[model samples]
Target: MRQMGRTNRARYLATFLLGYALSGLLTGTWTSVETLMDYFKYKPRILCVESKTKPYFAICPFHKEEDLLVSGSIRDTGIWDSDLTHLLKVALSLYKEAMLVDLGAFIGYFTLYAGALHHDVLAVEPSNSSFKRLRQGLLLNDFSATIKILNKAVSNKRSYVHMGKNQKLNLGKMHVNSEKDTDDRENALKNEMIETVTMNDLLEYIHVKQAIIKIDIEGYECKAMEMSTAFFKEVFVPFIFMEWLIIRTNMNSNETACTWTDAKRLVDYLTGLGYTPFAYHPVFTLLDPSAVLDWEIDNIFWQHKNAKSLLPYINLLRKVGPKYFDKMDQNQV
Candidate 1:
């Protein structure tokens, strides 16, 4: 009986291995064929891909495979990066004529969306590859004359800075002062130094009467706020969309991440400038001034005191449900 049991187990193991090998081979064959098809479909030059937000393109000569995958995913799949589509539609509708300022505007997703809506747009991007793609996307959509593109990192200081070392996977990861002390200097990724500018510097060139700003500069929100306080005081920016990433973690060090203290300071600074903080989870949920001190979330929208008239629009967005925002592809210009 023991001999018979051993024979059954060996047969089962052999069968499992055979099935695994066959499945792997089939998958490899399918992937190769699909990749070849994609190369032919989008070869010679990167093609403009349409998302719910707007049409855009991405290209990285050094990381051609990954770049093509990213661009193709956006083109072929309608479901790529649709999280903010709904919210942006509602927000853009509220202020049709407001200037849209897209900081860290990688590949010009928001910039193109605003331009398509016929709103004057100012887009700032640091990485060389991303900026090139941003320009391509703008021109592809025939929005080059409508939207202004600046290839500079937005930071507290107007000086040149190096991109982070691990940006080979996605150029979007590139940011100012991204090198870690522990990173091996000899083997580290070498990125070109890009020019840096402040929000105030860009504001001088904007001729728009009203403005809305969207900031997603990795973990440099605090530094940006510190630099743009004067601009906030002088300008009546109705809405400010920024990422708030100050949550409690088990990590031993807080040096690399934005802390609760940084969030509180930013909230205080913005509030002092007469802007109210609210959570932007695809719907406009009002946030108490002190709530941001401890609350953990990614996107926060701040409304200026002068823009109290926008409350009705916010309420309308709340009643429309999240689905209403996704069906806005038809609203694209």
Candidate 2:
């Protein structure tokens, strides 16, 4: 009976291993192999990596929270958001004097990359923990002089808002509540009062006339943009990469942000400003302005339609295209 039981257990183990191997190959997710590769990418004690040779970027290692975002790809996967990063390079090429603005900058992945590229940068982070980490990353990369960080929220008004942190994983992706709305008693104690600034104020603070901006400010992007009509009309923002995956209509249950009407308001506003739309996911795709916009896409790219200098580069992007294949580079760190 004991011999029979041992044989059954062995058979079960063999079946499980075989199933895993087949599934991994079929789904293109070989977790064990990827784990081994990421393991060698960074030194465990230091929590930082290099791009080629010189020290590139450092991350906040507390619960490895910073790694949960774009920095994770930069450190573990050997590649970051090459699409947006590449697009940034292209825009910077067009406007040589423009600055890179990373709004809601989580530990400064894009900001660090831009700073390393030797461009002036402004990284705005509202969360305290993330702000501290972003500053540390700048100091580590030796970009303190060129890259300035603002510990404030980008909002419709220049006032204080209550922000609650995601203690579970991301300390940066906080839940912003208005001073008028105090219904969330659960996270009330955890919520901190953070000062807010408008998009115009941000650009003015950095003395940036022409700018390339990345907006990842939770779901307040629409509100901020709506409030910054004057800034958008006056500033030379040739390019903007904005987070489009909305907070949904029912903010409490995690559904759409307010029927598609609210999102349309945002699109209409941008279109009125002479900006063309593009989606960042499934590659850098050019979106038809007349078609129905999908708000579920993670990120959206907007380029000035009237900029004469932007015409050629955008046409070339449509012709050649950018690839985001996360290839394992041996010296990626």
Candidate 3:
């Protein structure tokens, strides 16, 4: 009996040790030595950047497929989506009076750049942690007054929502939980209840005549759009740029992050609004409304007929191919 007890204890200890090792390994998987070095070196600092035509301040970003175009691109360019950033500038110049409604503004790259140009802007971020970072980054600029920051998530209606975490991604990818989905009651209750605003409700805050809207709400954008029908009807949004990862139909739900049914609804809704979609390969190419799943663009512009006045600029940009603005050195990153 004594020998048997000894063997069992030994086995138990070995098993416990193995489990602990695996847990540490799994937790530290993404935290490579290089990532650790970068974290310590540049964790939280304001970067002064002269992005060609626009000089702005960017806050230290969290680890993201963004900390930014993601894959740690900020270390090189001190910017992400340079193509999209410049594109917004051009849109603002053409619209002149257009307000930039930057939803999911994520560290305020688009908002920072637009506000630096002295454009009226409303920037929204859902995550408290990310919202703090975004606000700090934007406020460090001289044109901070030009931007209005909101810490609530935008949904189809005003309500309380539980925010969900995608550990695989960064805070910018944090999303509103679908009422039916969450890990469990205990953790759900622990998570902060986020307030939501309908897109139409946003209008009361900004008297937007024409707007350049960027919505990147992870998978929740489809649900948010359901309530945004009124906003689209009321606002003259010439450029509605969105992340198609949540609405593309060609891929399975894993890739699109939404069902084919939801994707179809989103696409139909935009089309019914008389918006034509355009993507750029080497130049801006008009996309077939039904086939957004096949689009190869990084992001898309749903151009309404109202934006025809800006066609010459779009044509020129595409002719020049995609321009990448701001290649700052390590200190700026």
- Predicted model with the maximum lDDT: 3
lDDT of candidate 2 over 1-333, digit per residue (tens): 011134433443344345445546776755355423432333333244443212234443333454355545554544456566556666665676778888888777778777766679988988776775575456445565688888888877776767764745455557566533333444533555677788878656567577788888877777678678667666688888887664432333433322355566777888888888877566556776555344446778888875534445445555666432122121221
Best by TM-score: 3
Between candidates 2 and 3, name the one with more favorable lDDT: 3
Model 1 lDDT tens row, 36-98: 233233232434344544332222122335554334345455333454544555566666777
Rank candidates, lDDT, best first. 3, 2, 1
lDDT of model number 1:
0.61
What are the Cα lDDT values of the candidates?
A: 0.61, 0.62, 0.63
Clashes counted in candidate 1 amount to: 0
- Pairs of colliding residues, candidate 3: 65-70
Regions of candidate 3 where Cα sits further than 4 Å from its true position:
1-53, 63-71, 180-190, 249-251, 254-257, 281-283, 309-311, 321-333
Q: What would the TM-scores of all predictions be?
A: 0.70, 0.69, 0.72
RMSD of each: 14.9, 14.7, 14.9
Better of 1 and 3 by lDDT: 3
